[model samples]
Target: MSIVAVLNTKGGVGKTTTALNLAVGRALQGRNVLAVDADRQGSLLAALSNRGEREPCIAVAQYVEGQALRQQVLRAAALYDDIVIDAGGRDNTALRAALLLADKVIIPFLPRSFDIWSLDDMSALLVEARAIKHVDAYALLTMSDARGTDNEAAGQAVPDDMQLLPTTVGRRKAFADAGGAGLSVLELPAHRDSKAMAETQALLAAIFN
Candidate 1:
């Protein structure tokens, strides 16, 4: 089984969104997925709770404490094909615990100054995480402008240790709209934005393939 953690030390970086979508996307591909909400806010839990009945079902659990999070993930590892953890927006015990067990880490950041600055702390955390175990980590640019050099600049700014994903998710209404309704871009209806679906699919392919 693969355990993936979507994390960032800054808020509003789309960690929860990435986790949610990745879980649902994998489930759609016939993999049993467990999505863990390690954030105190419980947004991931709430989102999965409200998902449409017709959408692919993703098992979810909320564990905020460090040891609880780690223990639960280990016990459930064999039950599910994939586990996606939303590790909140800070460097805390829960986040640290996730780093200890996750096989892959996906860090999402907006193409902006504050987000770029936060990567320094994330790099240090990854350094600490690596000392104990090996984790494949990748940086992704989210909410990127469709027309600008910001994406390129932000990609260049990513720490050398963390490879930047080639696929960038643009700032789109489809994500917000689908998310509000507890749905992924891939699950949206006839009027859904094709670009949004395409971007999300590309992201999943980059990570899982």
Candidate 2:
């Protein structure tokens, strides 16, 4: 089994959205997925509840304490093919705990200056964590603007310790539309933007490959 933790010390970077979509995507592909909500706000669980019966069911567990979180993940590993953890957007106990158990770590960030600057701190944390664990960590660019900013140049600035994914999720109405109703962007109807769906699928492919 593989455990993936979606985390970023800075909030509003679409970390929960990414984690939710990843869990649902894997479930759609017939993998037994378990989503762990480590954030104090419980946004992940709330999103799953809002999902209703529209999307594939994903098992969920909540663990906030660092040691407890690690123990829960270790125990759940035998029951699911994949575990996706939604951790708080800070260098908190929950995030550190998830990092300890995660087979892979995903750090989603916006391409803006402030968000870009935050990666330095995250990179340092990841570097230290990796030294004590065997985990593949990546930096994913999300909420990318198609206008004004140079996405490519921005991606190049990712720290060498973390690999930057090739596909980026652009800021689009489909994301908001789907999230509002607790649905994965992939589950959006035919009228939805194909680019949004395509970007999500590309990320999933990269994640699982």
Candidate 3:
């Protein structure tokens, strides 16, 4: 079993969205996935509650911090094939605790100046996390422009300690719409944007394969 934590020290970096989609996408792939919301905002829970009834089922849990969070994740490790933790937007006890157990950590950032700058903070946090335990980390560019040098520039800015995923998700309306409805691009109806689905699928493949 693999424990994956979707984390970024900065807010609005698509941490929750990535976590939600990752959990649902894995479930759709027939994996026994459990999504753990370690964020106090509860965005993951809110999204899952609105998920379509026909979509693949994904078990979920919430734990903010302290011993309980660590204990529960350990207990869940025996039951789920994969555990996806949605950590808060900042460095805290929860995030630190998650790092201790996560086998992999996905850090999503936009192709922007602020988001690029946040990578340093994340790198440092990961350094601290690694001091305690070994955890593989990756940087994923999100909300990238369809055609621009921004994506390339941002990809190059990723910290050396973190591997950058080749698949980049564009700034597509389909993501926002699907997120609002608590659904993934893969679960969108017949008119779903092909690019969105393709990007999401590519992301899952890059991470899970």
Candidate 4:
């Protein structure tokens, strides 16, 4: 019965990747999961198809556009144990509605300067989401390389007011290939015991545990 919205005002920051994998990752762990494709771009939907899901993924746009029955939205989603909304990279009505419904709002960003710089914008959006739903949001650092001491040090330098995930995804090709297959990084055998999976699992654990 928990709603998690994956957001970042800045696109290409692994927001969709996080949303896609985290949903599948949770489901693979035996928790029922529903992935809501809220972005009109249909990136999630395209990725879902690549993953070869038998069930129709519920696209919020379709619900809003009258292509699908709205009453069936939550009911269809409820068939799963967890619901994830891929909110794209902007602030809009759909994103707002997802925020109001979310129990946790997870924002993922890279370790670069622009990625770090974009935090303020997302934080403001999180504030707006909180103003509507009264829920706190957290940020997760993605695509990090420990060997790149600078990125590692940057994460350690985060202020107390900000939250940086303890586990980080090192530079790995598995992520890109896995996404192409509609599979999560966790779903990749090589990543099962990798740091990326550990970090992702830790994030999921924080939410469900």
Candidate 5:
């Protein structure tokens, strides 16, 4: 079993969107998936509410406070091959614990100055996180538009010192619309934006494979 944690220090970076779509994509690939909402706001839980499975997905709030995390993982692992943990953006002990529990870590950043600044903290956390986990950690820039900004090229460009994923989820109305209805963009496509979908899919594929 693998524990994939979606995290970032800054809010509104599409961390939840990436988490939801990636887990759904993993499930679509024939891997049973358990998704956890570690954020206090329950964004992941809200998204999965309509999932309507006989058994509910495990939200991380219950286990994030203590060593109960091991038990939580054990219970969920019995039912799913993949476990996706949606961690909080703020710096806290709970978030640190989630990172320690993750097999692989994903930091989703937006293409803005403050969003870029958030990666500094993300990098430090993962550095310590890697000492505990055996897998590679990745960073992905979300809501990016290459043709729009002067920083576009550099925005999507992976930091030389940081490990990053190859795909960047572009700014799109579809993503925002899907989140409002508690659905992943993959589940709700208004128009054909193959680029965004492909980028998202590649990120999901890379995390699982």
Candidate 6:
């Protein structure tokens, strides 16, 4: 089994959005995927509940403390083919706990100066994480402007110590719409092959391949 954590030290960088979409996308591909919500905000699980969706199709579990989080993730690894964690947007215990268990970590950042600035802080965290575990980490631009070159510029600014993913998710209404309906951009009836879906698929491929 493979375990991945979707994280960023800064909030509102689309951590939950990335976690949910990745979980659903993998499940659609016939994987036994389990999404773990390690955030106290419970944003990951809330997204599905708010839209009245439930599983067997996509299993979810919430555990916030470091000990419990690590224990649960380790146990679930034996049963699920894939595990995706939505870590809290802070350098807190939950995030640390996840880093200990994850095989790879995906950090999402918005394409703004302030967001790019936070990458320094996130870099420090990743450094500490890598020192203790053999975890592969990458940063992906999320909620990027579709019309401007800001995303490209931001990608260049990312620290060389941190890996930056080529695939980026633009600021599209389809993301919010699909999240509201408790579906992934790929799971949406129409726009199944739209830019949003393509971006999501690219991220999944980058992470899983």
Best TM-score among the predictions, by candidate number: 1
lDDT of 4 at 107: 71
Q: Compared with the true structure, what per-residue lDDT tens digits does model 4 show for residues 111-144? A: 7887777778766666676665576576777777
Tens digits of per-residue lDDT, candidate 2, 15-71, equal 988998899888988999999999988888887888776647878778888888988
Overlapping backbone residue pairs in candidate 6 total 0
Q: Please give the range of 10 consecutive residues that has the lowest summed lDDT in model 2.
A: 51-60
lDDT of prediction 4: 0.68
- Provide the clashing-pair count of each candidate structure: 0, 0, 0, 1, 0, 0
Ranking by TM-score: 1, 3, 2, 6, 5, 4
Clashing pairs in 5: none
For model 1, what is the error of residue 114's alpha carbon versus the real structure, in angstroms, after optimal superposition? 0.5
Query: Which portions of model 5 show Cα errors greater than 4 Å?
Result: 53-66, 146-161, 189-192
Sum up the clashes in candidate 2.
0
1-209: candidate 5 lDDT, tens digit per residue: 78888878788888888888777767666677777777778777787776565232333233454255556765677667888878767976657766787778888887777888888887787678677765456888787776767345545554544676777788887776666655556665536566667776778777766
Off by over 4 Å in 3: none
Candidate 6 lDDT tens digits, 63-179 = 989899998888878899999999967888999988878888888999999899988987888788889878788898999886878988999999877799979898888888888
Clashing pairs in 3: none
* Model 4 TM-score, 2 decimals: 0.80
Error of 6 at 96 (Å): 0.8
lDDT of 3 by residue, 1-209 (tens): 88999888899988888888899889989999999999999998888878757558778889998467899999989999999999958888898888788998899999999999999998998888788888899999998887869899999899999999989888888888887766778888757799988988999999888
In model 2, the runs with Cα more than 4 Å from the true position are: none
